[model samples]
Target: MISINDLTFLIGSRALYDEANWHIKPGDRVGLIGANGTGKSTLLKIIVGEYAPTSGTVSMSKDLKIGYLNQDLLSYDSHLPILNVAMEAFERQNQLQKEIDELLKQMETDYSDDILQKLSNKQEEFSALDGYNIEYKTNEVLAGLGFSTEDQLRPLNTFSGGWRMRVMLAKILLQDPDILLLDEPTNHMDLPSIKWLETYLQSFEGAIVIVSHDRYFLDKIVNRIVESRKGKLTSYAGNYSFYLEEKALRSEIQRGEFKNQQAKIKQEERLIERFKAKASKAKMAQSRIKALDKLERVEDVDDDNPTVNFSFKFTKTSGRHVVRLENVTKSYPNVDILDNAEATIEKGDKIALIGANGKGKSTLLRIIAGTETFKGKVETGHNVTTTFFAQHQLESLHLDNSILEELQAFAPKHSDTELRSLLGCFLFTGDDVFKKIRVLSGGEKSRVALAKSLTTDSNFLILDEPTNHLDIQSVNILIQALQQYEGTFISVSHDRYFLDSVANKIWFIEEEKIKEYPGTYAEFEVWNSKRVIPPSKSIPVVPTKKEEKKPVNTNADNKQQLKKLNQDLSKLESLIEELEKAIKEKEAEMADPEIFNNQDKLSLINNAYISDKSALEKAQQDWETLAEEIMNLEA
Candidate 1:
């Protein structure tokens, strides 16, 4: 739907993109990825028309509607409730509703056919636009994005910046434009919210071009990957995994080609040098020199992509039971966040705390860390020193201090050289360490906070969303470092890939209870899938005496049950696929200028499209439930 033609953008003397050309077609889900400072966001801005490219044209269909969610937080009316803010996306629907209300009031006095006809027409328009479902859809999205019904009614100003960002995200999703330009949409979302977004986007008809550091999110949603590097755009035809494999292969090939070319050039140079001094070989030498001058040099690829490399050094070993909580109860004025919650952390357990927002995952972490009071027995084992990294810890940094100073304050015993080296691991190098904390960007400050946390010699770490602002590389570095560390940690993270790599145990919190699942994140997913539809709590079926007298056909019954389940699963899958196809067909029809111009046809197709999408989502859930049941039965 949008075409970037030979686009070039310059930031001061640095070229962000040079002669970059890309085409985004309808239903294309592209994940824009690259290292930090590689202009991914800038490219998105150019596409969204927020910033004009230095050269070339970004052309789009004149009727195409684009929704751009930038990384920066939006400034909205703080007094307005979050639900109201989200509903603002359907401004036309809101206006029509207002008009309808006024028309109803007028009808009470005039009772005229003209007024009734006007109201009827407006109501039809609203129904055609699915205006009646606006509140339902809005609430659904808000809930999926981690807003409780009560929270929805709370004023927007009551939420933190991160939560406000989520409200903005809900608004954009509600808008449902033809194209989405999302930059780090999952930055503020928790695990459940991210999963909800993944499911939502999977059925979204519009084209999606996202720039996110969350690899798991990209893998789940994006069909194509585009890397912005060195002012050049490279396209990968698959998800992040494919991109990694392909990039490694390409890099290796490039490195070999470069080496071979360098060897040939050196050989030619040597031949010319040796033969140049001889009068008999002067012509040959001159020819060789000209060839050398005309030869194109292969640029060497640098392996150094700036990675953090630090490991936690535990000051002392903790007892076998590092932390223990019993009958933990934390409450607010009228709400109980946690009641009768119990959990245990071993000496070397790497636990991932996961749950929906407001489920008290962070509160549990704080309670265990002794930062928050609870009406329960919370005990830390002997020598269990703790290093806590809160979600907002970066925001609470000493602004006046430099990055170097911040780390120094935490690790005063370390030498200046050692401190600088540690900072370098976190991507703060040389003069970057001298940069004032107040001057750093959110991501930079996050890095500094992480650096400070890593400097601590603690046996246990309580981290809440530590990967929120770190780039993909930094996250990977952290994964590697954590893999090597012997210290135990309980981290609350939404990045599935990161959790899969780092977490050895899963603490799933639901209804104030922490259920422990002993496995990696991937294994936890498999286990969770099987249990999504719990086994029946009712009594088992008992055959009557007459039935028992006959040949017991248990095997036959089992086979029949399995066959029927398989058939149902297949039917649901087929129905979902058909619905998706219908939705896509309707979307393509809506994009057609002829169909778009025809108001009656547009309304019909739009309503059908919405219905098809809704059906597809339902069918998918049914398919999943059946599939899970089948798997359980077979096992």
Candidate 2:
């Protein structure tokens, strides 16, 4: 529950919000919608107390707890395991457990009434905080976000930026705040995760305010829409579809009013010009002029939103069969992502890869694109020029290069003017083209990647999660461009609307097998809904027999091992803390103007900072390992 009253935010000469007022009640599901630069995200930050409004007040309940999922990936200790990262959400619970453990250890030596009382109190506090169920809840949330069981134990640094964002989302969800402020929450999630999120939010007790470009997701989760435009906010009561219809009707009425107002102003101007010269009518002319001056001008209505206009051109046409795979199999140590999967893609075919996360959809696409090694017969037709866009393509960008320079590398022959025009279509205009890739937001980086992918001529396109950070208008424009493409493409996307619009064929991957269906996404959904699909039988099962236990060590021996491990863990933690503090101090020093002004000093500090961060990460990993070993010994 929150209330924003007469809020006004300004940046330089530009006004993002002018006297905007809105109220969010309990259980309200509100979707924030606007063009890319209309301050939708900025408004969310204001509500979350990250940004202060230039004028007016934002009031919330005193007991309200807000969970915010930031658009940018926050800095983290890379060496920490993801499970520990998620556990950070339960601060009080973790503290209680730590106290309980320490108290128990103290009681083992003291055997005093005071220690026993403290231990009893801590145990009661732990139970009240649901400390025992923390592991179960953490595992459930992580799995729902597409993390494998083994992945929870892996260090955070091993995952890509997108996956790291999912880790952040898991932390926020586990926090269970009274309100949720999510910005493009589904950008990094696969279809299965998105579906799970939708279901989870449906029963959420608190209010939610989300800024998303996923239309289907908005339709499924939001019960209200808030549109920001012209430094003002307007509220509509309904889902996204209902909001669209209502907005269209409002725009139509506004257009009529604007036209009528323009006509009246023109008539008055003509009358004033004609009568002002005559002495007899001068008074009347002055009256009309004053009236015109006092009247408020009507704002012109935009018929349609701005969109990108670009087309893909192929250097040469491909043969009848664009791609073919025979008995393709991709396997890891103990898991088979794809087992003898077979499929044939004809020329001009637009296929959509759909399945649960980690079910070989991307793997299949990689095999076809010749990026991954597989045990199978894979062949591309004659004259087929393939271009592949990986899911983490944005991260692969040269951060030191300007956006214009990045595109120029792909198209060396194109003049600056032509490249600038191309960048304009992707919403990078004027000085934006000169910005280094490192300063760009996730969505902006994604656009640069998409623009670069279109530079070279290719007949077969293989894209993974291409629409992850795209806005609705941009996605529509991209869909229109792909519709007119003459080449074949295979894209893996979780956007149901995008698939429905672009996909002419469906490749469903399940249980390490690919099932091909010849139809649109709607048709595929219909057939899937009608049929009673059987459970997957390919999942490997372990033997039910229990293993023979080894002889247990004596209590004294176990206690000694535990004591050594605890000492190691304590030392490692102390080292990690010192490294973190040093790194922070170095970073603060580097941020000073004098430090950056000196080239030699700046370089020295930068190197030291990097070294310190690396040491900190290693120390964190060592600390985690020692702590786990201690836990095992104590158990």
Candidate 3:
């Protein structure tokens, strides 16, 4: 569907892509992968026309439709119900409906034959556009992406960034584009949502390019692997696991060639040096020098995976019993998290907490950290010093402090040199250690927070969504760190690969109670999937076929509400744009070192950010108030 040839993209004097070529045919499921800053997301933007190649062109059919989902897409929000926002995907249908509505209003005043004819024409066009099924398609896509019927009626502005991202994805999916470009699409998804998306994409008819660090996801959804390495797109003909094997074979061959080539080159140099001084052999020496200069040297293989190179040490050891929770109960405004839930962590236990969203995985982690309120008995084992790393803690880092300084402040027990060595293992090199936390990307900040977590002499750790924004390389580094850790830890994550690599036990919450399986995530999945099957009987998944979607009818009330939405759509769009812009500005100001230093300025900036979001929330509430008349308006 798309052809990329001899593409070269430059950033300043650096080449992000150099004469890279790729062809995406129909139904190509490509997994684009590389280290952070290797331009995976940038390449997606280039395909979507948001960015242009510095040299070369991306050509495709004129009628090609592309759907792109990225972090920036989350900036879009509206006070309209998510259902209506998703309905906006039917652009031509909406226009036709509006014209038909205008014609109907005209007929109400004067039932002219001309008005009647125009109304009939518009209605015919709307039907031809499949406008009758717009609501059905939107609702189906939203539900598949893990939204409830009630959630579809709630305003887009009321959802958090992660949820709003799903709404955006629903809109994109409803568009039914010829190709989809998803960047880290699973970063915000839970296990169930990820599985749903995987199944959906497996049935998709069009091409898809996914950039994600979730290897299990890639293995499930993709048939081809494309590595963005050395400023080129190298194609692999199978899933990620296959690519690993193929790449290893290629690396071995390259290493051999590199070694032989280096030896030959050294021999040629030695011969030239010995012969150049003699007048009789001077001419031959020049010819040999020229031949050596013209030789195409082989590039040595670079290690993509970095491991633990620094000594990981803890000053104290915990007792045999790391932690004990008895009769823990916690609840929220609408959902009950725990009802006398009980679980335990023992010395050297590596547990993975996983479930669908709103299952209170993070809440449980907090209760263990002693940072959350609960009505239960939580006992900590003796000599247990703990370190907790959560996404929210990334903001707790001193914005003005350099990474080195932040680690120094947190790890007073370690000397500057020792901390520096530790940071290097986390991929923070010489100058990178001096970068202010304010300027670090999400992945970079995650690394710094993780580095700080290791700085503690604590033997017990709790990490929440530690792999959320990290690239595969960063995730690998984290895996190495976690594997090398001698203490007990409980990590909350949706990454199955990460869990399988580090977790010895799996913990999940169900029916407001904690459940445990004493095995790796892969083992747990196998057991869970077959939990209901009899031991003698086997699951017969024969002749598997996907469920077909058919057009469904919408109720009359929703039709009226959808029509009425046209009048307020533009106003809501404008308001959302302003709110998003204000939020970004306030956030940037809050990150300013000067503002961070001045307590008053920091408070004012933080307040402004909160106020901007609150205003957006108020706008959403207004939409909710309208929703009885807008969403699910049927009496």
TM-score between candidate 1 and the true structure? 0.82
Residue pairs with clashing backbones, model 1: 308-425
For each candidate, the alpha-carbon lDDT, in order, equals: 0.83, 0.82, 0.84
lDDT of 1 by residue, 220-245 (tens): 99999998888988899989998888
Candidate 3 structure, TM-score to reference: 0.81
Instruction: State the RMSD for candidate 3.
Output: 16.6
Expressed as tens digits, the lDDT of each residue in 67-103 for candidate 2 is 9998665565468899989989999998986776677
Native-structure RMSD, model 1: 8.3
The residue-by-residue lDDT of candidate 3 on 514-612, one tens digit each, is 999999999999988744321111121111122233375456645644566534544555666788899888767755645533446755776566556
Instruction: Sort every candidate by lDDT, greatest first.
Output: 3, 1, 2
**Model 2: residues with Cα > 4 Å off, grouped in runs:** 78-80, 109-121, 307-312, 391-422, 430-445, 529-635
- Best model per lDDT: 3
